[model samples]
Structures are given as structure tokens and as C-alpha cells.
Target: MELLELPLDEHLEAVEKAIGEWTEQQKRRCKSAQRTSSVEVAKSEEELRELQKQKLELLEAIKQAEVAREQQKRRIAANENETRDLQAEIMKAEPIITSLKSRENLHQGNLGNLNQESNKSAQAHAQVVDELMKGISLYQKLGLLIDKKRENNLAFIFTQLDPNNPNREFSFSLRIEDNPDVFLVENCVPEVSDVNELLDQLNKTGNISTFVRAMRLRFKNLV
Candidate 1:
């Protein structure tokens, strides 16, 4: 049993079998490593695809946000323009409003003055009417007095007596010319035979009372 160990051929065959088993084990290991590497590459490719999709979605969102911002800016600008226009219109109207207020005040003052003047004129007209009434009353009284003094056949006329006709029995007239306070007194006597002589005497005397006295002396019963 201890003969130099097995024969030389038996030793060589054993060594060859061990070497073949080791080589087959190494080949299986290399194939497993290659499969693992392929799976990792596939996972990495899937992650890259997801990243690309997310980037596209983010780009779209950003674009929409930019468009909305532009629209908002335009609206703000339009509002600012409208506000400026309103302010300009108000500035233009300010002076006209002030002038209208001033004119209204002036018109009110003029109306007040006109009312006061109208009241004064009405009062003055009433006073003038009262004076005219008083004058008419006095004229009637004088007419009645002259009527009482006249004789039965010789009548004394006060109104509308003709100064040119000396044939009338007795005529007296009061006439007011341009002046309301001053009057002219005219009298005619028919008893005086000569009308021209009586006119001459009246002109010379220039006094109505003297002419009346002379007429009374000439005719005792004449009025």
C-alpha cells in the first residue's frame, strides 16, 4: 500500500480532471456578471426616460405662466390709461364750473336789485294817483261856488267856456299849462257893451280883480 504512491499515469490523470472543473466554474461566473450588468443598464435607461418626461411637463407649465403674466400686464396698463383720461377731463371742466358759479351769483344780485326798484316805482305811482284825486275834488267845489253866485238870467259857466265869445253872460275858466301848480284865470263879461274896449281895458290893467270891479260898477245887478 505505500508503494511510491500510485503510478505516474494515475497522478497525471487526477491533475487534469481538477483543472477542467476549475475552468468550467470560471466560465459560469463570467456569464452571471454579464447578465447583472445588462439589468443595471436597463434600470438606468428607464430613469433617464422619466427625467425627460418631467422636463417636458415643467417647460409647458413655465410657458403658460409666462403668457398669463403678459395678459395681466396688459390689463394693468389699460386701467392706468383710463385713470389718466378721467383725470384730464376733470382738469378741463374745473374752470367752466367756477365761471358758471360766479355768473349765477351775479344774476341773483341783479334780480334782488330789480325787485327793490319795482316796489319803489309802485309806491310812487300810488302817490301820484292820490294827488290827481285831490285836484279833481277841489275843481268840483270851485264849480259849485260859482254856480251859487250867478243870477237867474245871467249864468256863470266854469268848464268849456269860450273865451272868444264875449256875448256869454258871465264865463270863468281855470286853465293849467305846462306847470301843474300854476294856473291861468280867464273871465268874460257880456254887459260891457264894447268887447274891444273891455279887451283893451283888461290888457292895460293886467289885473283880473280890477276888471271885475269895473264891471260890477258899470252894471249893478250883473254877476
Candidate 2:
């Protein structure tokens, strides 16, 4: 599947600048071509004909640009909605899985320990995993890069942690060619906390000194 993610405002600005320059060049070229084709426009009919053609070309260019802009807005909106929905799904699953874990510890052995709690925890975990995978797949479809630090969030983690450590290695790294927004943990256990929030802050915080100060507060492990 293709990797698709939302472009931040800066990226959209760059796109607008590039498009504006291209459109200006196109307008100039069209006017130049018309100059080369100019004839005796002393006649009102001929002048009107030329004006009509130039106006039509400009109108076409405006329409094309508008269509492209609207499409980008739609794509960005859809991606944001997808993230919110997936986050909500994970939030809903959190309590159920935590409850199952506590229940399992309370009833671990008997002549017939049903293991129902364990099964539910396993199932709840699976549901979270599945939802995350879907989120990742949707990211792949968006076709934008969300990372400035590295590739996806998964790669950012791997680069920080040692792969040889049993507890550090992910089952596999979640990678999408140009996007960093859809990293998901799999098979292997992850450091339990809010990794997504960490990534979001990293992207949002552009300056290094500010980020360090924020990290000290958020992780609480920093000296």
C-alpha cells in the first residue's frame, strides 16, 4: 500500500509558492506567444477575440489550481479524522485490558482455573494491535512525510534504542516510505507510556532548547 500522511502548514506553504511561480511563468509564456501572433487589432472585433482567448486561458488556470487546492484540503482533513478515530479506539480498549490483567493475577491457580481473564486481556491487546495496524495502513495511503527527525516514528525509536536488547527490539519496525505518523508496536512488548504523544511533541516543537525543557517535564527521567 502507498504511504499517505498529512503535510504540515510549512509544507503547504512551500507548495503554494512553487505553484504560484509556475503559474506566473505559464502566464508570461502565454502572453509572449500571443505577442508573436499579434496582427492588426485596430479592428474592435479582432481585439475582442484576443481578449476572450486570454481570459479563457487565465480562467482555466485558476480552475485547475482551485481544484488541486481543494483536493489537498480534503486529504489532510481525512487523515486527521483517521488519527482521532484510532486514538479513541485505543482509549476505549485501555481500561478493559488493564482490568483483565488485574483479574488474572487474582485468579491464577485452581483445579480448573478458567483463564478467562487472561484470554480477555489477550483479545483486548489483539484488538488494539489490529486498530493500530489499520491506522498504519491508512498512513501508507496518505503519501506525505510526517517526520523531520527521521523516517517514521518507529525508525526514530529504533535509532535511539539498542536492537540487541531483548526488551528493546520491536517485533519489527513499522516503516512507510516517506511518512512518520503511523508507527505501531507489534509482537514485542513496548515501553508502556504515551509514545505517540512524545512523537507529536517532537514534531510540534521545532527548537532544540524548548524541546529539551519539555522532554524533562514529560518523561521525568531526565536529569
Candidate 3:
């Protein structure tokens, strides 16, 4: 309320204090800006280093690619030589293949001929065996029929009868009972009186034995 005048020195001193305070404030703002600039510079340096590393890697990869290309070219050259050698071998084998084919054809023809001959021989042999067995069987029946004739053939058949028989000590035979080649034999003992009668019955049943045996003996003598 009293308009009392202040001293000029005091007023000047207050102005100087205000100026110092403003200067301090500006210094703080400058320090903050400087810190922000330093951070930006560090980030830029890190980015540049990363880019340089990437560039070196790219250079190394390019060098490896060139080396791989050279290796591929060498492999191709070697394969070309191998292909040439294989082609030559194929050409040389042409004559051998032709000769082998001819030999195979000859072998096939020989095998076919051999198979035909073998089949014919086998059929002939089988026919001969059947005929021989049939002839032998017919003779056997005729001879047995003569047993009742008191012939020596009856004695021979008796001797040939099973010597190892366990259930029977004797065997009986009736020849020419039905067919000329058929004989009916049983395990039995015969009466000596029945022998002559049995031979008579055989002669009547198989009337062909005497003539057949005579002819067989004659034929065998000629052979």
C-alpha cells in the first residue's frame, strides 16, 4: 500500500538472479537434446556395422557359388568320357549278342527233337512191357491147370508156395478155373487122392495149357 521506492542495486541484483535461473533452465534443455542425439548416433553406428557384416556374408556366398559351378563343370566333363566308353562297349558286344542268339535257337531245336524221340521211345517201351506181362500171365494159368494132370509143374508151384506162412502149412491151386490166365489158390491141405481128379478138372476147365506150353517151349528153343 505505501509506494515506498526500492534501492536500484537491489533491483539490479534481482534481475541478475532471474537471468541466472533462465540460463540454468536452457542448460538443462540442451543436456536433454544432447543425450537424445548421442543415442541416435549410437543406433546409426550399430545399423552400419550390421549392414557391413551382411555384405561380407554375401561376398562369401558368391565365392562358394563360383566354386560349385566349377565342380559341376568338371563332373560333366568326366561323365562325357564315361558315356563315350560305354557306347564303344555296346558296339563291340553286338556280334557276341548275335552269336548267342543263334546258339540259343540251335539248342531250342535240339531240345524239341530230343523230346519227341524220348516220348516215342517211352510209348513203345510201355506197350512192350504190357504185352510181355500179359503173355507171362497166360502161360502161368495154363501151367497151373496141368496140376491135376499129375504133372511136374504142380510140384514146382507147390515148392514155390510161401515157406514162411504162419497161419497155414499148405497151399492149394486150381488152374484154368475160369479164364485161361486165371488161377485160384487157397491156403488148404489136399488129399493125395484128389490130385489126379484136380488135374482132370483143370484139363477140362483150361483145355489150352498142354498145346500152349508145347508151343512156348518150342518158341523158346528157337529163340
Candidate 4:
């Protein structure tokens, strides 16, 4: 029962058995540490894959935004070009519009002048008619039976007759031509007459009585 009494071989065996147990415990601890290191490596690799995927998505979004920006720029440029062309067309039409307005004003002015000239010609013709009626009244006052027999293009025909005998008659005519200055006498039986000679004498003498005396002498039978 005492230590000294125990055998030496038994003591040696006991020491060897304890050493083997310690070695086995250290091997198990080594295996557990290796498993934990492998799990950590797997987790790190999964995190890296997630980060790479997020970066790729960001790159794709950036590319899409750039393409939209380029499209907007093109649309703006096209609109600007269309506006410029429309302005150019408007500028080209302005002169033609002005020219047409000027022509219309000119035509209106010419029409106004023509209307004034027409009114003046009408007034002059009315004056000539009034003077001719006065001359007819004077002939009637001279005791001559003057009858308006007929009318033609250039003259009015009148027959001067002796009141006692209708057959003893002379034909007198008053004529007007386009020229207002010219005076005419036609069909004088006793002598060919130029009334212009009397008008010239009247202009020189400035005497209405002399002019009347000349007219009476020229138409002595009717006077």
C-alpha cells in the first residue's frame, strides 16, 4: 500500500498513460480552430461578391442617364433650327407687302385726277349750251320768223322766213366742232361769209355795237 513498496514498472506505465491523454486533447483543439478559420474565409468571400454587384448596378445607371442627356440636347437643337427658318421666311415677305401697298396708293391717286378732269369738261359743255340759247333769243327779237327745222351731227338747222310769205326763206345753220376756237358759217346765198372776220373786228374795236351792225349787214334780208 505504501509508495516505496509499489513496483517501479507500474510507476513508469502510469506516467506514459497520462502523457498520451494530454497529446489527444491538444489535437482536438487544433481541429476546432481550423473549422472556425474556414467559416470566416467563406463569409468574407460572400461580402466581396455583394459589393461587386452593387458597383456594376451603379455603372449601368450612369450610362443610361448620359444617353438621355444626349437625346435632350438633340431635340433642343432641332427646335432652334426650325425657329430660325420661320423668321427668315417672314423677313423675305415684308418687302413684297410694302410694294403692293404702294401700288394701291398710286392707283387711287390717278383715279382722283381723272374724276376732276371729267367734271371740268362737263362744266365747259354746259356753258356753250347756255350761250347758244341766248343767240337764238336775239334772232327772234329781230322780227325774223326763225324755225328750228332739224338737227344733224355737226349743226342745228334753222329756216328764216318772211312772215308774209312762207316760201321766201333762207336756211341758216350753227355748227360746233371738237375745237372750241373755230367758228363756221355755211349756205349763205347772197355772199359767202366768214363769221371769224366779224369776231376779229370786234376783238380789235372792243365795241359790241359794231359787232351787232356787222351781223345785221351780213343777214340783211332776215334783219
lDDT of each: 0.56, 0.51, 0.55, 0.59
Error of 4 at 58 (Å): 1.5
Pick the lDDT winner: 4
What is the per-residue lDDT of model 1 for residues 13-117, given as tens digits with 9 covering 90 to 100? 788877788778877887887788788888889988999999999999999999999999999999999989999998999999999999999999999997887
lDDT of 3 at 149: 33
Model 2, range 1-223, lDDT digits (tens) per residue?
Answer: 1233345566778999999999999999989877755643345667788999999999999999999999999999999999999999999999999999888777665413546654554565455445544444433332212222332323212212343442342222333222232324332234435545654554464232333233334423311
Compared to the true structure, candidate 3 yields what TM-score? 0.51
Residue-wise lDDT of candidate 3 within 13-119, one digit each (tens)? 89999899999998998998899989999999999999999999999999999999999999999899989999999999999999999999999999999888767
CA deviation > 4 Å runs, candidate 1: 1-16, 92-223
Give model 3's clash tally: 2
Ranking of models by TM-score: 3, 1, 4, 2
For model 3, name the residue pairs that clash.
148-199, 149-199
Candidate 1, position 3, lDDT: 66
Report, for all candidates in order, the number of backbone clashes.
0, 12, 2, 0
Model 2: lDDT of residue 146: 23
Query: Candidate 4's residue-wise lDDT over 71-120, tens digit each?
Result: 98998898899889888988998898889889989988988997887567
TM-score of each: 0.35, 0.24, 0.51, 0.33
